[model samples]
Target chain A: MKKVLLSTLLVSLLAACAGQDVKDQPQAAVEDRAAAQTQAGADAKPTGQQSVTANPLKDPSNILSKRSVYYDLDKSDVKAEYKPMVEAHSKYLTSHKDAKVAVQGNTDERGSHEYNIALGNRRADSVKNMMNVYGVPNSQIETVSFGEEKPRATCHDESCWKENRRSDIVYQGE
Target chain B: MIFRKLLVGAAWLLLAPLAHAALTIEIVGSGANQIPISVVPFAGENALPQGITAVIAADLQRSGLFKIVDPAGVRPEPHELAEVNYPDWRTRGADALAVGSALPRSDGKLEVRFRLLDAVKQAQLDAYSYVIDRAQTRATAHKIADLIYEKLTGDVGVFSTRIAYIVKSRSHYELQVADADGYGAQTVLASKEPIISPSWSPNGAKLAYVSFERKKPIIYVQSLVSSQRQVLAQFKGNNSAPAWSPDGKQLAIVLTKDGSSQIYLINADGSGVKRLSYSSGIDTEPSFSPDGAAIIFTSDRGGSPQIYRMSVSGSGAQRLTFEGNYNVSPRFSPDGKSFTFIQRVSGSSFHVALQDLASGQMQVLTDTRMDEAPSFAPNGKMLLYATEIGGRGVLAAVSSDGRVKQRLSTQAGDVREPEWGPLLKN
Candidate 1:
């Protein structure tokens, strides 16, 4: 019985890890496709090695790649590293007319849950507004606040807090 | 020398019995009243784990303001706000009703959703959903109680908060953290010997507790998030009563490095150690004033454990509690205008008492047996403490006006030394 239980636990852990890997695949593809597009543009100017046409869906995984956007302590200002991913997502939403996504914001368990919920909503709204400005249709975006209810990491200090202060882009059903 | 001083104090106690009577008035004048309300069982497809509805109902019932109707008392089952018959509830004299439900989420967690409804109008006043781990079902119940309380009374709920307490399990004493209602309790640190004075950080992320895990009672700051811990101070003789500053920057703790248990301020990262008290007698329980300017602590320099206020920079020491012969663990309210401390009468049991700084008036908050470790809610409208109810150590809460009182108990061992953290930001 103990052996069975241990194996069951191990299998669940592995499944969770696999799910995380699957979540990372889209973003990885996005970077690869963007790099390939840049390389193709550079090659056309050089030795003229058969000018390649841009394949927008060369990496369909890029659609799912951008998973999260992080914020500073008590501040919802989007960081520079997340700008490209956000713009890419915005462009994708603009292209895919029927696609809808929900931005869920979260916080570390530092303050009152109510206050954190409000702060998380503000963060989600900020991201939604940014996407709208980037040409993503407002109808395609929905904002929700999970406050500190959902945490990627549960440590007490800044290490865990940095990870918890994030807004996740969850794709709505087709 | 300590034994001799105890003997002298005992002699004074025996000779001056009438001298202590004046202090008794501080607690006896407060009157108690019962507030009536109804908490209907939350609707759920599957019966929630660990009787969440019952726990929340009991919490409201014990608050003295609420009169929870027995489960058999309501005739027709009121599952949702729409299903609640207002005439049926109003005839039963229920001012409000709380309805809730729990659903299993895709993440293997349970999402317990609740809505508080006004019984007369049958309208939803507050609604919330709690995503809880499988192991934390009981905590979710307490959170529900906190939610309903806040909605009805317009006060911040303390149910979702955790209490750090010292418990003697088996032959060993351990420092433990449990839900404020004393459920889902687990030992944070255990020792073969003794552990005393567990203080929660202002952010509720870490705990500063005195543990004898190092053979001596030393103060250690342990993070609740990572389970990482480090000894803050292990001085020669005594290291006890670690109180976190409001800003989470400094910790006011008791250290005997100066040959006495004097108050000292150390950075939360454990540097810039400075003494705040130069008293001759043992001074302990140094709680920071809400504004962090002064500390209200227990000192025996006045021949007994009298509450004294001393500046954080170690100047302008003044006596705050003159009436009480034994007053310890003085915690300032969030507004810093009022303070709560344990007052031990000569013959009667120790009671939790609140002191108004502006008027110098005192009121007894608890009539229970041996109440101690009073901590204030972030709103300063309520206080939580540990008291012996029916010979068992349990956590309890009393409203600011002493009109509402509630007892919180757990399924496990007896809990002692309850500490409340600041109001968490959502």
Candidate 2:
């Protein structure tokens, strides 16, 4: 009897998966095609020599790879320590006209939810202002504040709060 | 779906005293003068179908204006004022005494009568009677209590009012409503996603809140009686912070669809969409003044979060607070003379503060380390807000004069965003 019940459960689970494939299969195929086209483009570049066109955002050693900049409590000013990281991303955005980025501002969970929304937006705007001063076009950058809704840490302490208060730089289609 | 099951499992208790005590209210402060009163058990209670005297006593005790002297053993049951037992209650330090009786009718109804007496003068103060069924017994008790409270305190009692709040545990979030004294809690809506910002309609029939069920913040107006809800705002971007206008004809919401967060007004039926405020920085948390003349909100236009006021037509933009570097969540008092907001001092902690609109003078009310969402009671006598106690979120009430403080906490998890409902006509 136990074996019969187990088999029945396994068959039902497989049937559920088959039903899901009807809705998700086409999207998965489209994603696979896009991945294959990107691979083909990379292969078309000459081999045996270093490729001239390389996205710095994907380069491990480039400062543009650093995506997040931390801020102090209730403060939106970009800290001195994260200046180099912000500058590098600003330089990349100004040079690459097609590049578009979204600066998402966040805050620690210590205040009202809606107030944190405003504070988070200020932090994101601070980053966008710095990038604009560095010659990044206004159309290439967008700012949004998630407030304290999306916290990086769950611990209720200063160290965790420091990690949660940050602005993340996200590149388009990365 | 979870709420439907929980509602069935709630074991609706109409007459019996609450069995499951989810939140315990700890009175930390009290007024100086409390009128001492003794409420004797009602006679012929077999037909009452509910604890009439006990509910009345609990309602009076919750006001913090009356001290209850137990008459369980010290006094005898007297059905009328002519019984002449005022000497015994006076000796027990009770300035006033209440006696009542419930008689059964042949039509399966109850005739409840009560009399209030002045123990000092040995004279009758008031007497009333009502014919109600079993289902209306609890409401009758609350009504009797409100009458007694008004006769003594010269102010209407909020015993019959309702309170709405959000309760979150693990991944389950439920919007629960209870009596003003935090008893007889009933779930309004439950979901695995988060729920916040519960604003009651002026008529106390519906609620406006933010639900994240669709993986994005959406504003919903839900009816209190039935579980029916309507999507008031579901624009492309974030739609949050829904505040109902006093007339119940409009709602002020914060929407991010127009590039940045800004305040917008929509009809109660979700028809008209009109932008209200214009600012480069984030403009959100819009609260209407009591008279519906202007709106007070938080904006970062001046470098940091500060409270700003704008007319109903979005013209007379002016700053309201300059004492603190961080201020947000401004809610006007019921009389429109003052407002309350959360003010943070130099990154130390957040406190609830009240500012007079005319004088511009501010006074801090709470000493909690992290306080948010201060809402005024409908009577304008007390304020209800959310605070953290020992790393757990709890709801608390403090008098407007800053004299009385009480903590309302559940057994586990967090309870936040308490909005006191309006007084309904009985």
Candidate 3:
């Protein structure tokens, strides 16, 4: 449980600049994983499966680890930079026939809630469409828009709003 | 073990009633032409559960239409029409006087007699008397206030109506139905998840709202009286934005089951679902017109979100709003000549705006930023909406002409998605 949460946090922190080679990228990445591990309060259990059979979805080096794609204000389109990441997930879905995913679309805390709901629905559908483009079967994907209900960040300014306009892909039973 | 269990059960029952009636109201922006009136303390009304004159006065004052002149030193509270001393009220600068009395009847019921008098003309304007049960005190007071408001303002009164809103605290979300005055709130549904888009049935008996209790939006219709609820829509994907048609037999709901958040019409019993909109882009927030012949909804088919009108027969839709790139939540007035919607003035500042259908004139009703869920009072005299004040979500009502304003909020939690229920029929 601790490793999974730490990996999720690490992936979210790297969503914006995952492939970049910044001077402090590896150091900050290690620090965030360490902090999240301490908060989870559990250490590695020396499982031999972590070496050759680690879940690719949780491996920080893999693009599949990044689940969220942030959008512009009131926008539902997956940006050009995020397309490679979304296509990677779509390829994963196509390969894993039994894996089902729900794309949860979210929005910033602005505009009418009902309109935002529709906007978020479009966002989720956009991801589903991208998956369909990669030959992912319709039965493997579903969409739900949380609108502005579940925010990644709570502050009312643009800093938080920018982080909140997002769509997250979740595999079932994970 | 049974004794301890019974004590905990009793404690929960004791605290249940305390959780209700938390919504309080504050009136601001007085009417430019407020009528001066004095509502005297009703004789024997102090013995009842609710203050008759106080409720009446509050209802009138909250509208920003009437001022309650203090009757502190009026000698001998008037109980009958003959004893109302109009000249004394005229000297107190009151143009009208409301007097009443409540007494126990022979069969242990209560009898309430009320009268409205014109101070300048020195004549009784309206009189009403009712034999009611103790449970009907507050409603009867609101009815009397409604009668007084109608007699003076020449418009129907909505004081006897109810409003439904979602209250979000840290622990859970509660859908509450309260009096129009924000009193006597009763929770209709509570869940650990979100509840939104509360739509009142045309007859005012049921509320059709979307709840995210099962990790997805599903439409449900719950009886305000019996508390019995059933799912109206639970399709393959998200089913949300339930709206009642004027006839009450069918509902217009938005569904993503077919993809792209299209609008659909379904029986109120959750059967006979038929697709109503087929736009390529997102189309949602469906609101029915007063005559049920048309539906006004938000659609992005024309490249941006705007209000559009379509025939209920699933015909082609015509866009209705052209002023803003973002216009949604279109609610028709009771008379159907105009609609109230949320218009994004610019980046992030959304205001409640009204548009007349005949002439393309639009009127913005509020200066408050972040306004949503605008529902007209049954009479179309006021628009009740959800807005953020000091970063706390609260319910607010703006007069149709944007002259008067008031706020209703709970001591704890954020309130949003307010839908004012209709003036119920007996």
- State which candidate has the highest lDDT: 3
Chain B only, TM-score of each candidate: 0.82, 0.88, 0.91
Q: What digit string (tens of lDDT, one per residue) describes model 1 on residues B1-426?
A: 111121111111111112111111112222243434566666663455566788888766655445675544666777655677777767877667776676677988776766666665556666656666666666566666776665555555666666777776543566778765566678776655446677878878899887544333567889988878877987654567789988899999876565446789999988888988997765778888878898988877877668889888979989989875667778899889989988876423678899999899999878775676788866676688877666566778887788777776654555676777655543
**Interface DockQ per candidate:** 0.01, 0.22, 0.32
| TM-score of predicted chain A against the true chain A, for each candidate | 0.66, 0.69, 0.70
User: How well does each candidate reproduce the native contacts, as fnat?
Assistant: 0.00, 0.38, 0.62
Candidate 3 TM-score over all chains jointly:
0.86
Global CA lDDT of candidate 2, please?
0.76
**What residue runs in model 1 are displaced by over 4 Å at the alpha carbon?**
A1-174, B1-35, B70-76, B104-112, B129-137, B347-349, B377-382, B387-398, B403-407, B410-415
- Please give the lDDT score at residue A86 for candidate 3: 69
lDDT of 1 at A59: 36
Worst 10 residues of 2 chain A by lDDT: A22-31
Poorest lDDT segment (10 consecutive residues) of candidate 3 chain B = B6-15
- Once superposed on the true structure, which residue ranges of model 2 sit more than 4 Å away at CA? A1-65, A78-103, A125-144, A169-174, B1-30, B44-50
lDDT, model 1, position B419:
76
Cα-based lDDT at residue A72, candidate 2: 82
Ranking by TM-score: 3, 2, 1
Global CA lDDT computed for model 3: 0.80
Model 3 docking grade = acceptable
- Identify the leading candidate in terms of DockQ: 3
